[model samples]
Target: MIGKKKTDATMILSSEDTRLGPSFVEREEVYTPCYCEENVWKLFERLARDEDEWYAVVISNPSRTAVVLEQRAGSAENGGLVIWDYHVIAFRAIGGKADLVLDLDTRLSFPTPASTYFSRTFLPLDLLRQQFGEVFLKVVEAKQYVREFSSDRSHMRLPDGRWQSPPPDYPCILAPDGVGRFEEQMSITSEDVARRREARGWGTVLTLEEFRDRFL
Candidate 1:
């Protein structure tokens, strides 16, 4: 859920460095597969408190049917597909320019253009409704809608059998110093998510290409 933070007059108009945007300098400190909603919301809350232009966003496909493109360090072999579940990020409107998506968990530079973010990730309207509910979708502002679907990280668990409620300092699946492919390490895939949905008697599973054509 998003919480409004009051910002001072001076902080409201302050412009961030466009070169790097508002990304964290120490990238190693950022972790993944933790309490994504809570951590992302906390980061956005801090930014909103400091700058009035910044706002927190919680995006997800509760049906967990959407697929996103994930680029790693290598060439074609390094790239793979990932399913989009309940994820959170921050946003800021750039006058006359594409909006910014601040997703700390992603490898992309923080405050990347919204167009770029959407190109990599696909969130279908049908999936969004399943997660956020119908009434929330009627609203134009995402901030207003997210509050109704706020995630409780207290019950979140990691593959290593750890509770995400009390987030650890470094809750990443792959250590910063480790050398391994993220997809291999995480075993994240659209097929797996689809299987789970099918087992639950959900609708037909859509392929990645189909999802891209229909949603993107």
Candidate 2:
């Protein structure tokens, strides 16, 4: 589940350097703002499905007000930190070489070094105020996520049936065999990483620190 796993794809060390990762994923071509989950779905479907070398990273809070920093879309408020009810990204772990992160909204590189990304993206717990809310992480195997995750874009709709934000041009992502398991997958949220060592149907729930120690 963690970085030691291997994949059949070339271990090129950097997706950006190669311009195309496994399955020829071009980040800019596939990315859309506010559709991080779907963007990551395509990434894993292309690059990480054959093996365990990649994982989907979900960051959010029980309050639906997770705070993150240095996002390109962030405003001047909170020193340019952005508040996302939830956000998703793809993580690739290459042994010995630095691991990488693929965050569509970050000011950082498309596939940034794991260590740099964390240091620049996350606010320290000590500095975090209650108003900003706290964030937890879910790190799931890309294979598992691609197979189990589905979204109808219901979360983006207004009661009048108009989209709060424009939907992706691509059709909604559906679970394999049409299982429709998005909520079931999101239900595996928790920060007590040690207590939940065994991976659940979704993945392991981890605090930011636990996520770093385990996945970073």
Listed per candidate, the RMSD to the true structure in angstroms reads 13.2, 6.8
Per-model TM-score on C-alpha atoms: 0.46, 0.80
lDDT value, residue 107 of candidate 1: 50
Off by over 4 Å in 2: 1-24, 48-52, 76-79, 96-98, 129-131, 177-179, 187-196
lDDT tens digits, residue span 1-216, model 2: 000011123334554544443465656666677778888888776775344377887877666667787776776565557877778887777662337777777766656777878898988876654456567787787888877788877777789998777877988888667655655555334444344556766777777777777766
What lDDT would each prediction earn against the true structure? 0.39, 0.68
Model 1 alpha-carbon drift over 4 Å, by segment? 1-32, 71-80, 95-98, 123-152, 157-166, 169-216
Model 1 quality (TM-score): 0.46
The number of clashing residue pairs in model 2 is: 0
- For residues 67-159, write the lDDT of model 1, one tens digit per residue: 444422113453434444434555555452336666555555554666676566544547635754211100012333223233323235567
Model 1, residue 3: C-alpha shift (Å): 26
